[model samples]
Target: LSLSGFINIYLQKTFVSKQLSNLLINGVQPPPLPSKKKVVVDFSSPNIAKEMHVGHLRSTIIGDSMCRLFEFLGYEVLRLNHVGDWGTQFGMLIAHLQDMFPDYLTVSPPIGDLQAFYKFQKIYDCLDIKLIERGESYYQDQMVEVVKEFEKKGLVELDEGRKVVFPPGQPIPLTVVKSDGGYTYDTSDLAAIRQRIFEEKADIIIYVTDSGQSTHFQVVFAAVQLIGWYDPKVIRVEHAGFGVVLGEDK
Candidate 1:
């Protein structure tokens, strides 16, 4: 045989040997699977009044695929679209809309033009100073009442200007109220988490948000622990970490 022919034959023999070894191992029993149970797979829930951009599209695609896979594997899947429906941003969106049409934000569509609404809110926030002031005031008043009640009960406190929630060192004091007395992210998140657990009865609450927000999620999960919502062993809260997409390099 030619030199090249001999080399090819030798390579093929080595490949076959490796394949046989792999096949023999494959005959062993696979590891036991986890106990069958229902699962809640949350993903792609864009803020209610925000645009469904390319990133959101990717979330929907991946989340739905996961839902399907879990369903096929005999897990009862509950799909959650935890929309960002409430916040300071909404105050502007609602206020600017109230100024423009006087009746814009009345209709809370189940799933409607969120991206456009967010865009409109941004435009109003930038162009109109008076409207921004009004928006900030609106959200502030709403937060004060809740924080005062919590403070009176001694469930929360102000530390270093911001509302710090000291829940036995599991997590930092939650900032339900900001330094300016505005409702921070924690309040809305806690309300949403409570609703999901009690109303939706979510077995697994997976937050499919940006990885940079992992610390925020850890704090939220710790707060959940403080609130005594679920047994840490049974109920699962996870931040499904993922990276941002970048342009392909040549």
Candidate 2:
């Protein structure tokens, strides 16, 4: 399209959008002008043992900007880094430590390059099926120990075979243990959500992600609703999704 045509189309679209906004606002019973609102945001949660990539960088920058915007608007903003600090990655890491270098697992940060250690462990396991099984077994045992520790403190419970419990309808679940007696990401996330809400008193949970993740967020919110953690009529989950940041192909 020519420059004049593009400019004309842009103006027309902008005018239409403004008109739609005006119509909607005028048609609805508007809430009182903005007051104190609690906003919680989840971002930059990369999985354990995974390299942080461009996507994570985008989440960090965007989430920080959003939190700043809300803070400037006078809302109580809680920035949450839902770190992938639990589950299966630890399975492999712990297994390799126990099997190969049994002495170093207990050593403080004084001795080994932990990152390099995990890297080598991954390489070794990839080349050995027996090591894979051992890793799986170790993961299961570690999950049990973690669950037991939480259960002792009355923080976690095992249900059915492995389901754990959170408040019903709140998008949380009872992730006791997996069918393989392993701890799943869903289970660990359940713990994290519970801690964030009950311990931290988060009033809202906002997830910022690519628009493609909307379904994932929707299902999670539905689970929370079904599990009884949220009241659809009052509290809710919002996805601040954006389109892909595109550039010309190489």
Candidate 3:
């Protein structure tokens, strides 16, 4: 057979125009993933009482992009906005509010009007991004259980009156409970990760934050692995970190 004969046979078998029309209409199909996995992406974590800055914007956009990609790839994606709505700072704010407004219980406080003024949800709405707000306060009640579990597994130790856990090969110890019997970021993160794995049934968990928090998430993931919560080989955990956005002056 000659080149002309091979070309004639190929043209007869394949419909070139039809294939092009299909490509244009339906677009390209991406390869199937290994399995239908659930992905939980935590991002756009702006703190309470603070304005949303460039860092939060970057994280939100990046995380939403990843969620869209995963959804396109046939994965169940859960977009989470882990806001900083708990801590000692809130206690101080509450105390100040109470002091300023003595009859706060009987009458509506003036500050109540501003509650919706600086909400991060407004920004999400403007961007047309969907996210569930599960802040640190959501895991406040569960922190005690996390500490109990850590104590049960002998993963926690009393270091200078603070309950801390030292991940394997880590130089710094994670302070889960402070000396004042208050839960820290480590405790809430541990609780959140466990909830995402056990309750939410997430096969992959991705946290989008600034690069400065890379070590924090690393330590949290390591501690979770040490607790035997989830097998690293089975579940995928990642921290998608971005660089800091500096001001013009800096």
Which candidate has the top score in TM-score?
3
lDDT (tens digit, per residue) of candidate 1 on 1-250: 6555344434578799887888798754434448665666666665555554566555555666777766676676777655555666678777866676654468644434445455533532453311111222233444455456456667786677788776666545678877876566776566656655776677777767667678788887876677576777978877786777655871
Give the higher-lDDT candidate: 1 or 2: 1
**Winner by lDDT:** 3
> Cα RMSD (Å) between model 1 and the true structure?
11.6
lDDT of each: 0.63, 0.58, 0.87
Q: Which window of 10 residues has the lowest lDDT sum in candidate 2?
A: 129-138
Ranking by lDDT: 3, 1, 2
Writing each residue's lDDT as its tens digit, candidate 3 over 1-250 gives 6555343444643588888888999998778798999999998888766655666789989999999999999999999988778887788878988998989899868864556556656788888899998889898878889999999998888989999999998768899989998888888999999999999999999999899889998899889989899998999999999998888997
Q: Which stretches of candidate 2 lie over 4 Å from their true place?
A: 1-33, 105-176, 194-199, 211-213, 242-250
Q: What's the lDDT for residue 127 in model 3?
A: 88
Error of 1 at 135 (Å): 20
